[model samples]
Target: MASRQMQAAQIVEFNKPYQLSQVPVPQCGDHDLLVQVYAAGFCHSDLQVLRGQFGAALPLIPSHEPAGKIAQVGTQVKGSWKVGDRIGVLNFKNACGQCVGCRQRLRRTKRTDPRFCRKRQTAGFKHDGAFGQFMLADPNTTVHLPEKVSFEQGAPLMCAGATVWGALQKLKPDVKPGEAVAIIGIGGLGQLGIQFAKAMGYRTVAIDNRHEGRRLAVDVSEILKPDLVIDSSAPDASDQILDFTAGEGLAGAVVCTDSIEANAWSLQQLGNGGVMVPVGLPQDRWQFDSEAMVFRELTIRGVYVASMGEVEEMLKVVAHHDISSHITTVDFDQIPSIVERYADKSMKGRLVVQITQ
Candidate 1:
């Protein structure tokens, strides 16, 4: 029989439009699962990869956020996973168990999780990703999609949701319930961050400079909406935050935007000894006020995507809270145009491409 083929949007060259081509369906490895993708989410990192910022190899299938049903299972894949199982695949693939990151006792430690294994081939980055009809997914990092969540919502949750959720998890040790927490930048990640913080029992504040972001923050349902929304561009934005917190300042803040100014301003909103977690990846180095750091003894923690266990936990919380992802769903053929439009950074929420019903 002829080799099975599937249509995929591939980056034929750097700084060029993706070519939608018919490619052979990838076979599952001993430890992999073949997923028939239903929805794929577009992220800022995809733009960076396309611009050659990460030096990704050419002819790549771009998109790290993928959710779908299992089509096939590997021979060695021993688990409940089987055909037609709803799932969300994390970007990180096979991790080397011998690496320091993998051997570490604490998975939450900075850059020490198995997901950080240097030898790992990340989906959408080092390996073929989810912009295709079918993709190979690592069973270890994959999570079961809750019945309440749709494919479109689950797709972005693989990256954007996991990212912000992990960032908030870092603050739990120091920050407590009823204490104020600010989600800076109210874009794709920030929108979820606010809801997650609220669900986690924190007094969530939504901060944004853009009209679309600010609007999104206020538009969420009453239960999941931010307790306070502030315009970061306003001169008294800091004062407004302090007033909401009764002048104590935020207990913690999650910086969700790539803008340097937003990152810097997020730190200023934190009270003495407050923690600041930056989830956004900015190309430029971030500069901070060393004097404030020394006197306030504030903590700045860097976080990446959540571990498999955390992603599963996040899904439970998402389902229990009835959290929803604001998304714009488009057909798979529109991937090129969607990518081009995403360059303007005007998208309000997550953008997902529906590959199948």
Candidate 2:
């Protein structure tokens, strides 16, 4: 039998901060895996959840990206996974299996069940999440961790890495090799976006409005050997782009910034017929003029979270690609403490917390 209580972070109410509490451990269903969460990544989304942006499923355990060993499994589960397997938990836990979204996504992906499958329980968002010593995950969405990657390295991919990877795949039909691709916001997601875009053989451009963000963008560019890294924050920014692309504009722009202004400018900066993909979430409205859409014929796309199809592909990339997210690791007890800090936007990088450590 499982322990009656475990360490968890509770979001007692919206607008107020989270409080660390010892809560009853959740039980697994027939198809669930009682996972011993060794590592879990804290995301900006988690910060949003804390700020009551997503609103409380009250007392949320806010870690989505997690890597851990399987402690127990319920009946009806059968696959490559077995007891003690090390795997990465994905962000979207379950899509409503009966919905059109799930039907379409299920038809498109390898997993039998959709990760957005709302009918079942989720690790972080819906039910109890990964901010505890043990988390219940659907084995269908779990990606086996490679020996080369630590629990921390695998953590971010459970969400950020997969999100960017899936967006790129959707943009694949339009993105040609050797084309110029720009990414806004050099934060955690943007960092992985740069690497993924570079790996796809696109000439990458990393853009940021801040000093450290620019430096981080440049650092990724240098390592990934992107064609250029532009500071949109710098003076003469558009002029710099005009020279770089020679009035042709960028071949494509992945607007990881999610800000209306940043995304709008990036969309306007795209070349004729260029693809503008938005991966970040914004609190305000998305303002885009019809001219940019109709006149330039730019393709604007927004991706929330990746479907199950992207999980395996992303894991294979993580296993082979020299991809690693810059992260700050924390212990499970600090979930509420750190979540409050993130809500204010003062913290930095991918956050990976170990529940069992």
Candidate 3:
């Protein structure tokens, strides 16, 4: 039997550090699974949540990216899911299947995608999330972790990897194989984006203004590394990208950074009718030249995390390509320091909190 109480790192107040406390284990609903969290990822969104940007309820646990084993299975959940099964959970929970977003998703994909459901309570925002020993997860948005993927890697894939994968999927119809694709940021998400793009057979180019980011891109394994790493701050960076693409510019650009300047600058590097997907959530409003957009026929598509089916596909791709997340694992109690590191943007890659064996 699971313990009634578990250790958790919680935000007792807004714009304050997390407080470690013993909280009741979240009850598993009829349509939910009780997960014994093994690893939880720290995301940029977590920082926003700490700052109260997401209007998260106080005294809430704070990590949305969690990978774990099923401690108990709900009777209402009819599937292969059983206790002891390894899984990774998406942030959205208890999606109302009758809503317009859900119906539209069903109509188009013939799959009940909960990602677009407005009635869903986002983990770490409206509801208690990971950073605890256990959490309740909806089966609709949960995915089985691959044998080759560890909990540390799976944690970040729940958000960072899935977000980029979904963004690249948006460009599939328009961008052809061997076409140029630029991934801006070169951070955790950007690193995974580069691998996904490469695995998809796109000529991937990594762009970053920071020296550390540029170095990280270059340091990736030969098979997964981008075809070219460009300094986005360079005066001739756009020209360099254009030249690489035979003066046609990039076929697709995925903006993984939250910098508004990087977002606007990415538009200039796209070819005619090229698509740009913004995966970052910046507080500031994004501005663009209307004439340039109209003349170039540039496209901007905003994407959230991947649908459940897409997330499964992403895991398969990760397994097949041996894709991995560069992570720094910390003990659960070090959650406060992790927040500080993230706030200052001092971390190299994803940060994961080891919760259990």
Lowest lDDT 10-residue stretch of candidate 1: 105-114
Best-to-worst ranking by TM-score:
3, 1, 2
In terms of lDDT, the best-performing candidate is 3
- Candidate 2 lDDT trough over 10 residues, lowest sum: 110-119
Count of clashing residue pairs in every prediction: 0, 10, 0
Q: Considering every candidate listed, which one attains the maximal TM-score?
A: 3
Higher-lDDT candidate among 1 and 3? Answer: 3
For model 2, how does the per-residue alpha-carbon lDDT over 112-140 read when each residue is reduced to its tens digit? 45554546555566556777788888766
Which clashing pairs does model 3 show? none
Off by over 4 Å in 2: 1-3, 106-122, 220-225, 340-347
Error of 3 at 139 (Å): 0.8
**TM-score against native, each model:** 0.96, 0.91, 0.97
Candidate 1 per-residue lDDT over residues 78-182, each given as its tens digit: 789999999999999787866766667245453334476767888897678999999999887889999999999999999999999999999978999999999
Q: Report, for every candidate in turn, its global Cα lDDT versus the true structure.
A: 0.89, 0.75, 0.90
